[model samples]
Target: MSFAPFSDAPGTLDAAATAARLPWSALAEEIAALLWDSTVSVPARSVLPLAQGGSLFVMPATDRSVAMTKLITFTPGNAGTGRPSIQGDVVVFDIATGERRLVLDGPTVTARRTAAVSLLAARHLAPVPQGPLLIVGAGVQGRAHAEAFVVGLGVQEVWIASRSAASAEALAAHVHALGAQARVVADADAALPHCPLVATCTPAQAVVLSATPRSDAFIAAVGAFTPTMVELAPALCQHVALHGTIVVDTGDAGHEAGDLLQAGLDVATMPMLRNVVCGPWTHGTRAGKGPVLFKSCGWAGWDLAAARLAMRRAAAEPPMPAAAVRVPA
Candidate 1:
């Protein structure tokens, strides 16, 4: 069981391998344990604005055992250039030896971590994980959420929709291949009401989900990280009564998530996921309270947990095959 350090390119590590390494249940539990550990430290991530309306993010964290840093770049304009708007690399290193561990794909790690964190938060707020799940945006995060919520959490089924129908169909096919029941919807509105659990994964300036949501609905919005981007409508944000409070992955998300910021929300008062995971936060509901919201602005804590697991899983694998190149393993 040599879960040690190695050097690899950004995408040398496969997504399935990463997902397998960080199983949904174990990953969520480890994240909870990481939150429980008082010795671990994670500061606010570093952000630098790029000249082209994009931004660069430097996220670092450590459990005093494994240290990791993720260099992420978000360029909104890259949508038309055949390149994704979100791209980066996660670099993990050994704390004892100061040796570099492995480099996992940023988007791959981000997609899995974001969805898993959503699952973590959902465990506290949402009803039993056996209901329909509505996933907006048929991109990486959308597909990943289908895996997390349906395959990971045992959701009964998944409904996928996107701005592009072709993309939606593509994701639907992928989900079906996973042996999960899924279909492409015309838009999010049609599917939003039926599903009690929803994961919004998009970078839209306008709100994607509108109209009154179910009072008990649990939404996890992973996109719209910038102050200029908004996912949930301000109307929805304003109506969320105290009983069904908006949840966040980090303490400072209200400052970063455009949805909450635009809604004029006092995000400081919003419940943080760490508190919910650490302490006893009863999520029982009231009759008329608005829908529950869980918004994430990306966090270094999640990256560190995912990276450490990936490194250890890599080292534990059997010797690489002749047809396979040496990855982080």
Candidate 2:
């Protein structure tokens, strides 16, 4: 049989387009429902090491659709020899027919969806905070978080902190250009007191950053995905012991994530995102600490959802033979 192929070039659907299409508040509600529904199931992800320094992730899930996505992350050190620091593709197929119908450049989708998930977490876990916002890490995810928060949540001020001062300054400039009050802070700790809402977007191995929220502060950490990568200290997990909910992308994966692992915590006890959104149990006095701690280990369901959304949007456009044609047997 002959299969058809369609490609979405990088920036084809710029950050704004992606942000507009996937509204964080709406998507967060949908994610909450999906999590509570028993029909939806996301299998454990499979990781494959690339010949270079990066690794590829094969994520598969079953719900209304049986979908699989392949994601690869290459570091600068590996890309120097002509490899991309982050590159890959996603192929979405029709469940019954097993027809590969949608092809997407994975990196763009990854960044957008990752930010979308972070926004969802912030919306559900953090209390409404006024004033400037603090974003740790000035990479793609950091920028996307700033854009999504301002557009999705009405955030006014944005302060960025990065290992690279230049990167932080550049991100701050971009945010200001977007009409939001923003600046780069040399000290993340100092920025924390002023901003009630803090998001850590770095991939640091240890607790490179910390925050002292004023009684009602909300923190969302999405940087670390593996056991070796950590952005928040273990003590932060103790915050959950005091008050608020700790929402993890998945219980099993959290145990493998550095923030949770280093904290010497058990993921099974950590509340999943759905629990916090649905209020499975009264959060109790801990709830008084603030809203909650939201941590994402990254999930395949997110990729599947994004792929589905992108495909639906593409179909609404003028039909292209390559996009609509079926494979020939």
Among the numbered candidates, top lDDT falls to 1
TM-score leader:
1
Q: What is the lDDT of residue 165 in candidate 1?
A: 84
Q: Each prediction's Cα lDDT score?
A: 0.78, 0.68
Q: Per-residue CA lDDT of candidate 2, range 1-329, in tens? A: 75444332222333344444455555555555556656666788887776754567777766665465655654635322444356666666667777665555666667767777777767665666454678998877788788778877888899888888877888988888878999888888777778878788775655856554555677778878878778877766666546556678667665566887777777777777666556754334254565466777788777777766666666675544443333333
Model 2 — TM-score against the truth?
0.82
Instruction: List the pairs of residues colliding in candidate 1.
Output: 6-101
User: Which stretches in model 2 have alpha-carbon errors above 4 Å?
Assistant: 1-30, 50-53, 74-84, 129-131, 282-287, 319-329
Judged by whole-model lDDT over C-alpha atoms, candidate 1 comes out at 0.78
Task: Please report how far candidate 2 places residue 170 from its true position, in Å.
Answer: 1.8
Q: Backbone collision count in every prediction? A: 1, 3
Task: Encode model 1's per-residue lDDT on 1-329: one tens digit a residue.
Answer: 56434353333544554556677776776777778777777888889999978889999999878998999998878764668777888888889987775667787888888888898888877754566888888877888888887766778678887888888888888878877888778878877778888889986657898756677788888888878888888887777644467888887686788888888888888778887887655465323355778888888988888876777777887743433333445
